[model samples]
Structures are given as structure tokens and as C-alpha cells.
Target: MYALGLDTTSSALTLGISNFDQINRYQTWDLGRDISIYLHQYLEAFLAPLSWSELEWLVVAQGPGSFTGTRIGVVTARTLAQQLHIPLYGISTLTAQAYAYACSLSKVNEGELIAVEYPGQRGSVYGSLFTWDASNQTLSTYKPLQYIDLKGWQQLLSTEEIHHHLSPDTVEPKGICQAMIALAHQQWQAGQQPTWQDILPYYGSLAASPPSC
Candidate 1:
């Protein structure tokens, strides 16, 4: 069995392929402002040598990161999933960052929380908190994903038993794709299905704040 994963929620375009147990192939390219121009070419090249017929699932990081980049990734994923008639799973970009960190560190103590913050307009950030759930062998969403400014974020962090903090600049695309693949497998096992039509991009914007210049 084969599954493909994509992470374009940030400046990088990460692609992963899982041949059952682990990610067999992982690749990333920094797309920057040319994401729309290069996304399809890169995606096609990434899967060119693979056996697409055996690919049973598609997983993508769907939001709270680069507005244009995230949209490109999701739209591409949705199109492929629909055309291929395979199940698609959407993972939150913030959660993906946290999960990636947790996986990289190997063992996160129970109660150890991970916070992911991506810069947003007007000093606000797109953030989310996740805790290591030892019993479930997975990271659980402790604080719901939200938009908070630096001061507000600091206040919220003071209330948690956080072990790590991650920001946009620190994320590793490879790790993010790995996390996406893991989450996708979990959803597949739990019988949670995804509707391509329901997938949408989340820009994590503040109503009162104007766009960052």
C-alpha cells in the first residue's frame, strides 16, 4: 500500500510517500513566491517515478500558514484526490508543526505541551497548542487552534506545561510531511473519511487587524 502526503502551508513544498510503515521517499523544495507556477511541476515530478495506482490515500497540511501557498497545496490535493477517487485527509498546519517536533524528539513526556506559532498581521499569530498523549501514542489538541497576538500568546503559554515552542522559521519540511503521513494513517484506521469538497484554506486572520505590510 502507498500513501502520498503534501505540506505547502509554509514557504516550502514538502512531499512524502509512505510505503505502509514509514515514509519511503521525502522531498522538499522552497517555492517562495513562485508556488503557483511551480507547484504542479514539482508535484508531478515527485510522483512521476511512483506507481500511482497503488496510492490509496492523499494527506495535505491545510492552513494557518502562507495564504497563497496553503491554497495551492489544498486545491492541488483535492483535484488529484477527486480524479483518482481516493480518500483525502487534511491536517492542520499548526498541529503538523507540533506533531513534527514531537516525532523528532522521540518521546515527549506526558503533559509536555508543544506550541506552534506562525506570524500573522498586526503582531498577531496563528497558533495552536498540543500535548503529548502517552496513552494514545499521539499528540492531542490541548488548546484549540486560534489567532493570538504576541502578548496574548505569551499569556496563554504561561498557563500551560509547555515543553517546546515552534515558529515558522524553525519548521523542517521533512518533519512536517512525516507528521502529516502519521496523522493520515491514524484517520484511515479510525474510519474517518474526508470530503474533498469540504476542504478549505484557513488564513488565520484577525478581523480588526489589517494585512501585514
Candidate 2:
């Protein structure tokens, strides 16, 4: 994949470089609101030994996450992809969490469902359902991302018979940079090439309204 991946959808910032082979490196920082201040410097130093020109692809977590953090990441990634003239793959934060967990499983049932959710504003939740195919290291979204009340989320999970329910509080969203990179690599290997313009940060009714422009 020879790609650089980023995840800044929370209080932390994560960066990773990978080849989907032997070469893999990653770092995470709990910068909170100070992330924007140190982001450029961290990225520059993290690129180490290899310059931006050497990266063949770019990957980032396009979130259903913190409003400000998600926008910052997507904008930075989009700009880099545009300037580097490389394909950019924006992975869903929910999918990355599911992907990471799924990778650790020893086996899967015939129709296993992995549900991931993050607490949204006002007791609502941002969630998605994913089915991971271990054979090809690919993840398919069984239920698309949505914002719903906790009661609705519980009903959906019970109705769908989800086998695994994951949350950021347990797995830590900042640690999924490698998963984002891996998912992007799988898609790229499958002959998928997404442009930077096609990527956008997902903010699902933050504060029950659209984020300020």
C-alpha cells in the first residue's frame, strides 16, 4: 500500500505509515485541542526518512466523530492527496473499529455482524454495522452509518442479531490508524482508486444541528 494514514477524529491524533507488508510504523498523541497546533510538525517529523513524494497512497479516518477533529484530519489529508497526486481513501471510523476487532477473531459464523457505535450529542449515538470477510481482509457495511437514539440503536442491534458490539471507549479510536491504513490498502488492492475530492468528514447532527461553516 505504501501509504500514510491518519486518524484525528477524537481528542487524540494518530499517524501511520505502512506497506501492508514488513514496513509498518505508527504513532499516536493525545493532543486534545492542541492537535491543530502540533499536527503539521508531527506529520513532518513522522514522515521521516521518506518524503511525501514517496507515498503512493493516502488514507484517513473520515469520521462520525468529534466535529473539529474530524474536519481537521480530512482537510489535511485531502490537501496532501491533491498535492501529492496520489489516491486518497477515507475510511469510516466505525468500520475501522470493527475491522480492527474482526482481525483478532479466530473464526466467524455464516452471517456474523459487527456493530460499532459512538456516543453522539444529546444521548444519541452514531453507529454502523459491518461484516468482515477474513478471507480477503475486506469489510462490508451491513448497515450504513446513522445517528439514532439509544433505544433505537438497541432495537436495531437486537433485531439484527449483531455478534459483536464495539465502542470507542473500549478499543480506543486513536489506536485504529493501522486499521484505517489496512482497510484502504485492501480497497486499493481490489482496483479501487478514490480521489481526494470524493472524501469528506462525516458529522452526524452534532449538537443536533449542522456544524458551523
Candidate 3:
């Protein structure tokens, strides 16, 4: 089965294409402000030689990253998945990061929670807690993705904090597409049959809602 994964949650534009057994191609570009403007051009160029009809699954990073970028990425993924009649899987941006970090570790315990964090607007930061599942070599949601102030973030690291069990780790946007693809494959193996309508952006705020096309 062929699959494509996209991640535009950060300043970087990440793309990954894979067959069930191997990753065909993956790339990351520092697009900064031009992500939405050039996403299609880059995607088209990357997919120029690929058979669209053979693409069976579409995976995307539903985010706690750039609001506009996340919207564009999710909307694009939804539209394409609907048009192609392929299963669409939405992976959490933070969870993808945590998975990447865990994959880097030589050893990870089954219940070890990893806090993936990134800066947010003002003095806040986007944080999500995910537990490393040793058996599957993937991550499970430990705490729902959230936006917390710097104080809350610091407190989260305190011994008495609710998420104190979670060990903090950082993940850069570079090479994240591969991790997203891996998580998508894991979800597919687990029999997750998601539709285009099931894809949504997670902006890590109470007032934020999933983008509607």
C-alpha cells in the first residue's frame, strides 16, 4: 500500500511518501512565511512521478503549531483524501514529535511519558504528554495536547506537578515527516479507518476549534 504524509504545523514544510514496507522519499524545507504560498508547488513537484491512483492512505499532522499553516495542511489533506477516496489519518503534531524523540532513544520504558513542547504566542508554550509504548515502539496519548504558560510549563516539570511523570524532550521540525509517516503506518496496522472528515487541526487552546472546509 502506498501512503503520503504531510506536516506543515511548524515553519518547516515536511513531506513523506512511503510504501507499506519502505519509505520512498521524504524531504523537509525551511519555508517560514512561504509555506502556504508554495505548499502545492512543492507537493506537485515531489509527486510528479508518483501514481496518485495507487495512493491508499493520507496522513497529516493535525497541529499545535502555526495556525494558518495547520489550517492549510489539514484542509489540503482532507480535500485530497476525499477526492482520492483514501483513508485519512490525523496524527497529533506533538505526539509525532514525541514519537520521533522516543525513536531516537536507545531504550524506552513502556509507561515513560515524554513531554513534547514548543513555544506559543505571547509567553505560552504548546505542550502535549505522550507515553512511550515499548511493545509497539510508538507513543500513546498520556495528556491531551494543551497550551500552557511558561509558569505552567515550569511547574509541569516540578516533582509535584500532575505531569511530573513525563520527561521533557525537544524535537525540531527537521526530519519530522519520517516520524509522522511511521506513526501513520502504526495506526494503519492497528486498523484505524479514518475518513477525510475525521481530519482536524489541534491548536492547543480552548477557544480554538478545528478548521472547517
Best by lDDT: 2
lDDT of all predictions, in order shown? Answer: 0.79, 0.82, 0.76
Which pairs of residues have clashing backbones in candidate 2?
Answer: none
Give the top-scoring candidate (TM-score).
2
TM-score of each prediction: 0.89, 0.91, 0.86
Writing each residue's lDDT as its tens digit, candidate 1 over 25-97 gives 8998877888889888887788877766778989988777788888788899999889988898888877877
Error of 3 at 125 (Å): 2.1
Clashing pairs for model 3 are none
lDDT of 3 by residue, 34-100 (tens): 9989999998888768877889899898877788888899999999999999999887766767777
lDDT of 2 by residue, 1-213 (tens): 379999899999999998768888888889999988999999999998888899999998888787899999999999999999999998888888887777766675445898889898888998888886777666788888888999899888888877888878656554588788877877787899889988888888543332111
Give the Cα error of residue 4 in candidate 2, in Å.
0.1
